[model samples]
Target: PVVAAAPGPKEPKKGQKLSGKIAQIGDNGVFVSFGGRAEAVLDVAEIRGEDGNPTKAVGDDITATVVSVGETVKLTLKGKKTGDIAGLLDAQKSGTPVEGKVTGVNKGGLVVRTLGVRAFCPFSQIDRRYIDNPQEYVGKTLTFVVTTADDKGRNVVLSRRSLLEEEAKGQAEELRQKLEIGQEMSGIVARIRPFGAFVDLGGVDGMVHVSEISHARVNDPNSVLKVGQEVKVRVVKVEDLGGSSERISLSMKQLESDPWETAVDKLTVGEQLEGKVVRVVDFGAFVEISPGVDGLVHVSALAPGRVEHPSEVVSPGDAVTAWVTQLDADKRRISLSLVDPSERSERTPRFDRGDRPPRRRGESNRPPKVHRSGDPSDGLTSMGEAFQRLREQMGE
Candidate 1:
């Protein structure tokens, strides 16, 4: 039988990347076949993952960089050699991510060991958020993207934040596609502010405004929400600001059943309910009869006789019995009266339809004029005094 010589492998340029299947595993390295004449060897150290186990097995497809081109093609995954510096440049151009070990931290940033060289990662590029204690990242292994590979790999700048942001954007896009307005979803409270709380809906974030936190009035978001608390919320709005920017509005109250849906069952017209006055406005007082529900006691309904102002009858936090006079479910309004509706029905009308009531002494249709710096007899002094007198007369 005549023996024939096998053709030799074609030479690949230094730093050239190749994708192929693993042909064989050896003690020294793993052999890869590109379905061409060549079978490249991947260094055993470079093939291992962080757990110190080979990431690929024989017959598995692998992508590796060419470190040397010769009779035997040398391939390296981590590119951790002086000869692999060219691979770093190729990685920079292709936006390939590489693994690195944090060697130290400095005033400028972190010192990362990657591609057999020390690279600088700016403090801002270390993480998605500002690192208050940079020392925490010291001696930790991490993955990074090569942002700048200038001076032939002498000055390499790496950014872990870029990789993280890219991943977050991908996850956010997926969530956005699945999200729908009025859809109920779960999220974690990432942060709380006076105005609202930011919730982490998977990888994306949405804001729950203070007004939307609960059915009852919320003076502070912190009082209702705490960081890292899991909560169910409804998607009230989703605005795409273009290029991966999004504004999401969430409401916790919407996830729960609306109080008005059952308000009719619990309330009846002309029936009295004891409630606490939550707020007092110039026109009326708002009373909370039940949680997540309020009724308005208008100035005219405050007493049997013609009332000058609502504050004279009730103040904020005052406990009073208010008779529900009207319930408009479509309008989500409940008109209330401090004086019983029966009592108002029995009382005489203050004036006829066309006639105006007689004005009393010192009483005028127009607001009282309080001149600043006026004498005490005129009941006005400084601007503060005038404001006080005006507020008093207005029952504020």
Candidate 2:
């Protein structure tokens, strides 16, 4: 009768969107205040996490849709459904995720089918990695986010890379927590460079320096490591670069026992062992007595005679028997002798008698008498007299 019932507070229609502040949180639901004293109630189940705890609190600004409009409004979060364009549009507006199937590969990107709607995924947005063969993605189902969706659903853009990066970020955090120095891990060699090889461990990569590829000397990493080869490595170091990036140092040699630890026990001084000459220098030849163990055969010790260069006695790849003369375990050094120990000459005392005693004032100059197997005092007394005369002459 009066003014057509005053429009009944202009009730919002179902599926209509509204922005408001969370007025209060109750045991069963939360009340939101919108424009002109309009209020809506949201179900507690919508805001509760998997642990059965509320995710939202009072005074927080929230945007929700009107699910039902009666004496009081019932609200729901956007993008709750994904089977229709309305839901997809809501996902695009709210930055939510959706599922799609890769239909074909185009020059620009990938063709995706979602909710019976055609969507384009650019090559760069198709994956976190550079797509070398886009054909592999065809007929594969994947999850993506609706980056752009028009109201008419005529043009839609999807990004699987964004979702992949987010997932990798979380996985990277978990890996970093579990990784530690000296921890051993199995990985695949992803690439080889002159300096090192990059190994993929789970979702991260670590570098294995050429020197660390094996216990033996490594001239080129490609010779020992190839791409797609599986390897076992030890984590020598890990440096966090912040924001899901880290630098890791790995060593394949560290996983093996050090040869030097057993070299001293297995190789005894004066014992002869067969070895191969691996390298030759001006001073000595390096011979590999055992795997990852080397001993030096000096030029002077190559033979009983004088020698100028080590190559003359032992060339590279020469097989020879060597005597272990000195083993410096602390310095990881081994001194080898190519000349047999039995052939070495015994040292003897040599003295010149001309440098002995000079003539005394009244003494006759003559040769001293020699005795064989005589008393020890007789020989000692004559030697002592000669030394005294020599000292007196030197003082003059």
Candidate 3:
């Protein structure tokens, strides 16, 4: 008879303590065969920590506390073992906020990498303001808070802009206090509005008014200044015009040459200039000889030929060569003419229209004509007679 070797060491009974090497590991559980009639099944969770990540791997011989007796035995490795000090230290450090760089962007949020770990930053948590383009964050580095972490789920949520804004606000306030009028500074144009441009001056922001942009008229600030362009500006005014509030006005035109002063020397009577037609009105066409210096060319002086309106002769922005016919220095008025040559030629007559006949010495030098009102018989009443007749009719 084949001797069935005596049941090896009478395998530890169910609910009995057991110690064995982990032979196989799978998604379901770990199998521990201890020479018993049945194999013990230790759940994957029991082999791992609360995070669902296995603390011990295959081939790691561990002692587990037997919790039940059945075809499948349940065991707890943690119950049999003490807590890990190394893991506690790692947990403490992981919870601390860290710096991260944005690597990618998705519809859900931004993907940032920090400490060799991938983190997700939702759009709402990215910044204090709404972000239209998350891709802009790519390649930028920022600080982030560890909001959530799950080793088993492999999920890590982070936030950076929140931390940055908190730091930026403090620095901005400090810098704002140091700003003063007439201070020269460099700044980036952050936003352009109808009235002005907002420039980020270091950590603070200031306004460059539309009128202070250039000597030339600015209909819109964006036409000459672009967002993100760096420019130097001088602070013009700082006003505490209201309660607990302040206003900062900056100027770029003050840094540039004044067009009015530049044109002063060139502006004089009878000096000719090439001008650009700026506007046409019924009375005249205004031509810009220089940026801010414009002269009026009356319709009567537009051409030798009569023009009903200035617009019939010249349109806006047209280039025209004309002579400065007149200048009023005190009034800063300049008159241009296209008919200067014709006017001069007309003044110098080649020959007069002969001599006039001499009149009689003492006779009244007046022309004789029919006097209708003087003669009442002509049916027209004299002024004195009309007044007398009205007075009589009124019984005065």
Per-residue CA lDDT of model 1 for 248-272, tens digit only, reads: 9999988777888998678889897
- lDDT-based ranking, best first? 1, 2, 3
Reference-based lDDT, residue 9, model 2:
50
Clashes of 3: 0
Instruction: List, residue by residue over 1-396, the lDDT tens digit for candidate 3.
Output: 898875555645556777777878888688776556666677664555432346777778777767777666666564544323233235435755577788877778887766655567899899754566788888888877777665432466787666767776787777677777788888888778999998877556679999888877677998998876889999998777222666778999888887766565676667777988888888999988887678899998887776888888899889998888787666777889866665756754445545545667876657864454668678876777778899999996
Model 2: CA > 4 A from native: 1-169, 243-246, 311-317, 344-396
Candidate 3 residue pairs in backbone clash: none
At residue 120, give the lDDT of candidate 1: 83
Candidate 2 has a TM-score of 0.46
For model 1, what is the error of residue 329's alpha carbon versus the real structure, in angstroms, after optimal superposition?
A: 2.4
Residue 299 in candidate 2, Cα distance off native in Å: 2.6
lDDT of 2 at 59: 90
Q: Between 1 and 3, whose TM-score is larger?
A: 3
| Regions of candidate 1 where Cα sits further than 4 Å from its true position | 1-167, 341-346, 352-396
Q: Over the full model, what C-alpha lDDT does candidate 1 score relative to the true structure?
A: 0.82
